[model samples]
Target: MTSRVRLGSLIAMLAVAASGCSTELPGSAIAAEPSATPAISDARSGEVFGDLKACDLLEPTTTPKGFAAPEIERYESDNGCAAQKRGYASVSIYLVPEAGIDQLSPGQGTKIPTKVGGREAVEIPGDSGTEACTVAIAVTPNARMTASTSLNEGTNEEACALARELAVAAEPKLPRVG
Candidate 1:
């Protein structure tokens, strides 16, 4: 199981590095160095991309720090349209367990897009026993994603909403030469 987790982490890291951009990891902004972590060899499960390029997902063991702040486990996939000059698809799913975090969507008078970066954003309410929250942001574009989180961890709807915001944040990371 530990090996599986490490392998998942490595794939997730590669996907992010390939994009040439830095993203936050679940629980903290600090990253685990590749040279320090051992590699895992195993047959992977779950299907993400069909025709498009799909990378591994990052699973976090801790909670995040701020609003609409990017969770660390998301991965970006390039569409392979070398000449299109478009950016890679960014995806991240994080749990926001704060009481009001789940309700952190744009203000009542605010406007939000259902889909950003070609990936639709969704929020599912949840509870971690200690708090009432939501399972926010199961993002995927150029791929499919399914997230089933535990109820004991609480939810952060605000953070989930932020995941979408973070995914779109990749817009500036695209290559200027592309």
Candidate 2:
């Protein structure tokens, strides 16, 4: 075989093997698959909240005075939960892994960089400013604690401020796991 042809064949073989194209490699013992079950795509969510519900993130002790107690609801469709303070604001949390921290843009409302529980975050103003807000906290490199709120009881600024407070309360609650 020509040296060029031999080199081409080797390269192709390597590429196929790298991509798991062949189940077994000649003269080489294939490593055994991991005995442990593979992690779920959204496993980070469970890991961060472990045994804790979304409503648990609402800490009345940590909640400010202006905002009333939250009315929490859980949805089965997407394993999501939300808590709302009637007429004042409503905050909801979900697990967005590796979600970007910077959300400043036109027509996305006013986005301000801030901190929650001393962690980096961005406050995205909600529609009807008086009734909604969403705070995205960078809890971990792979997990983003998104706290969105709706304000019905106060001005846009009030709701955004409330959202920040709620995010602060929930930040510490999340597991600091990577």
Candidate 3:
């Protein structure tokens, strides 16, 4: 067969084979089907913390060393607060509804499982060369509160420690999870 005809035939054969392929696991009789709705539990339904503000969860006394009182800010869909000490450190708190600890990405850093107020949490160390860290505390399967710290002169461990401290301070203010 000519090269063009052979290539056409090969492409057609591949298309036919691909169409018959199933994503089911080998030896599994049932093929998993995608759910029409997400598998979110009642605790994670984004309604438990309705109208709660992130800044309200953190008090001025909770500010880390070298940072000033937190300044409250409300975003379109989320609430947060930030505290900063010029040339030292900046700390922020964010309340994320419908987002869980599992959704927290470490990027180039690492996620260390931890707990805040006996609730599941993750401590994410800053990426290389950055003095920043985050602690995410799970409120439910779909909601979490994050405390992030960035320092001008400090190690990742220090940042992580501060972040965890902030998370701990704010955890008690959250609604109890089932």
lDDT of 2 at 133: 72
| Of candidates 2 and 1, the better by TM-score | 2
* Candidate 1 residue runs with Cα over 4 Å from true position: 1-113, 127-143, 146-155, 170-178
Candidate 2 off by > 4 Å: 1-45, 59-79, 97-107, 127-130
What 10-residue stretch in candidate 1 is worst by lDDT?
Answer: 80-89
Q: What is the Å distance of residue 115 in model 1 from its true position?
A: 1.4
**Could you tell me how far off, in angstroms, the CA of residue 82 lies in candidate 1 after the best superposition?**
29
Instruction: Score candidate 3 by TM-score against the native.
Output: 0.67
Query: Which predicted model would earn the best TM-score?
Result: 3
How do these models rank on TM-score, best leading? 3, 2, 1
Candidate number of the best lDDT: 3
- By lDDT, the better pick of 1 and 3 is 3
**The CA-based lDDT of model 1 is what?**
0.32
TM-score of candidate 2 to 2 decimals: 0.56
lDDT of each: 0.32, 0.61, 0.78
